[model samples]
Target: MRRTILSSILVMLAGFAHAQTPECDRLCSRDFMFSLDSGLDVMPLVADGEHANGHMEDGRTPLIWAALDPDDEDAIVFTSTLLFAGGDVFAQDSKRGMTPLHWHLFRVGGPMKEVVAMYLGEGASVISKDNFGYSVLDIVNGVATAELYEVYELPYVNDEVADMIRGWAELEERWKDAFGMHLGRDPTSVRYFEVLAEEGYIPAMYAYASVLEKPKVEGFTPDIEQALYWYEEAASVGEVNSIFHVGSSAYSGTDTIEQNDAMAHEWLSLGARHGDTNSQSLLGLMYANGKGVERDIQKGLMWMIISLRFGEDTPDRVRLIDEMSSALSYQEVKEAEQMAKDCIINFFEHC
Candidate 1:
């Protein structure tokens, strides 16, 4: 799924570059030029030192051209060969001042992930911007959407590319400070999350809220009000975990906040509708017990079954399922199963 989206974006970027094949210069061989132009595996040809570092009339080196090729597999070998033969990793085109690393980011192959990493390993600069003042990070951030970032949910993104983006973000002290505490588990750097949260960084908002709600560091006490405030801030930005946490809090009630079943139902219903299984399970329990809304065992069973389908099987869910199943008639169970299936297929609309 991610690869498909990435390929579409890369095609657009490749078109944006609109590069024409360059006439081979005095330094480049026709054979080597053909190898690059045809997107062939370049290892065997570039192994010799003759044309490895050769450039075209546009000042684009063999390395830069390798980066622009649409085929990811051959591009990797092509990049590796040229770099091994001492191709300039920092080589930029005369027209745009874009580095090989920059062009490589637009390559369509998913495996080209390796090429990006290789550039970084060879000390290609992420800070290097093109003529448009767009750094490698800028290009990535501008192209990648929330769906891309949520792939594995590390910090800014999920995969190796995400680590690269985080490295770029770390160039700023505030990000470094926040990530240092959040990821490094350094209690002393906790305040940095507040700094970033104040700046409206959504992840930092979630982190800050968690710390306030349940401080692990010494010399800190839980502050439900502030915690709820930050959680609300993150929730406003569509941070699903924050939505779940807020619902969980309202359901159980904290030191200063009174239990409000209606508010709990409202928040949890929203979270459940958003496909949060935790919310689904809790909402199911509420419906089963008639704590907030009127009791409807079939709806409760539907939610519980759907939660188990999408989320991990917790002891609570397992035990609840067993109890609910035993009490439900066989027809009720089948009806609930069908309802869960419909809810999933219809994306929770009217579920």
Candidate 2:
């Protein structure tokens, strides 16, 4: 009788342990309706990081998981419940420090936009900074939805919050102007670009230079002088793309500025040293052709190979690399390829 009682007690204890093991996982796997109704009971389970949530997997909470699946109605409800239950909407992922709002803003074209608005309406903090000191507004500013500013405007907030919101709005406007150029909307976008440039937005200065470089219409009636002015302005701000363009323009005489290969070589060298692939490729061409400087086959091959390492591997780059490889011994080409791979690996590892 005593032995049987002890055996029964042990079995009950074992069953209790098994039941507690997946508490968090079970809560997370519950249907969205169940979670919404359970509220605080489910909250403790998520806080412990034992189950999968909307964006979170393995050990992530429902809040993170919901941000990634904004289109799912269940995800939306789960997120709303979590927020109402005092879940940290601004909490970051362990690896990337990305908040829920950050992911939502990045996915603006879809149902995520409405979800983002919902969070903001529920007092979800947008001004929370990431590891890099960038807010959600900052990350999304130049990439998507100028409407973010309007959505984020909250009334009667403190001075600090108000200031942050205003800054985000300004960045959104500047980014709109910058995006317009890429969409081929209008040259008038350059006017806004100039304004942002005057306000010390360095990227805007670069955009203005790009607009100036091309002709307004199809004719040879080029504005080389104006183009040079904007390019120099952008280069003065240390814009890498601007530096390359200015260098190339100086090397090849436009209608206004007389060709000076020496000046071109100088600017191109600056850009290449700064790691601008376009400038590096152009510099390699100059060396290969013996246009401005004395020809050295070895030096030319080295620069061309360097350019190939940095340049995009489009058809043009592939053809250039193949043609340049023909001039070098097999060993040099092999070494260059290895160096390029190493550079790529290092780039991603740090990034």
Candidate 3:
């Protein structure tokens, strides 16, 4: 009985030793909080709501620390492991509701894209609102970096955030000019578009195309071909406006290209199918007039009704839809209108 008891004691000791091994407590350290360069392996520290290394000074996680230093490899790894172990990526500090994502976006420089991507992929909510009600998208869009544009292109974000990013990319030049002068920089000739385009910014490419196509001074002419080329580049990256512009340019015979309604219809239809209200409205007009597809009043009414449902507060589109509805029989118009209402309800409810 004594020998059996001794064997049991040895087994328990061995298990405890194994459980507390270096690999098991990889991120368990006292000094990890202050030092961003600590090459501490963090995979072993499972995030179970208990501070892994007693590192929470005022309830801040190691992830928050990592997010503050954009280039800290150890910090990144530590945060990644914490997220993997079910750390709340959206957890707020005691002072504010800033999530790890907000910190990484606003603090980190260029390489923060990968870190942001990692958190997003792990189900970090981009819509997590801060104390001031600003979301991660708001924080990211506030930063004027080509790197931020690259982060915005990740497919994990929702359409709303993506649209905001695209709008910022389009207006980056205007923003730079307005703010650049305060920084003692040349405001009018900033190459922000070029830098962002080189970083694979689809919206920047589209904006560059617009600049290229704009009327030039008396000594120079707008480079239509180059504009078309950049538009094509933007379209290749799934930019809806770029697709719309390309189709419109082709139909209008701009840039010395022959007008081709059939090709225009193809691209416009493609954009409409991808949820572009502008493309939908244009395609509806074409169908109504028999300019592209066969004139099917029913199909035209359907597309127009759908576009009106999703379109912005545009008086012209509203007036056009009303006019088009007037041409339909009472029953047809009522049915189309009901369908549009149902679509709106279903979209909001499901989305």
> Each model's number of backbone clashes?
0, 6, 0
lDDT of each: 0.59, 0.50, 0.50
Instruction: Using lDDT as the measure, name the better of candidate 1 and candidate 3.
Output: 1
The candidate that wins on TM-score is: 1
Model 1 sits at a Cα RMSD from the real structure of 18.1
* Rank order (by TM-score, best first): 1, 2, 3
Tens digits of per-residue lDDT, candidate 1, 68-178, equal 455546445544533422356666666667777666565543335566666654446676667666666765665433243223321232367856655645544465455
lDDT of 3 by residue, 210-231 (tens): 6567632233357788877887
Task: List runs of model 2 lying over 4 Å from the truth.
Answer: 1-135, 138-169, 175-191, 210-226, 256-258, 330-351
In candidate 2, how many clashes are counted?
6
Error of 2 at 204 (Å): 2.2
Best by lDDT: 1
Q: Model 2 over residues 1-351: C-alpha lDDT tens digits?
A: 000000000000011111121234333332333333322234434433322224333333454644344234554544453343223555676545656666555432333434554454333455566655667655544332335433442212234443444554565566575666646765556677777767755566666666566644233244556766777776664456778767777778765556789988888877655545566667767776687989644444545544433233456555655666677788865654544333322321221
Ranking by lDDT: 1, 3, 2
Runs in model 1 deviating more than 4 A are: 1-176, 182-191, 214-223, 314-316
Q: Which residue pairs does candidate 3 place in steric collision? A: none
Q: In candidate 3, how many Å is residue 184 off?
A: 13
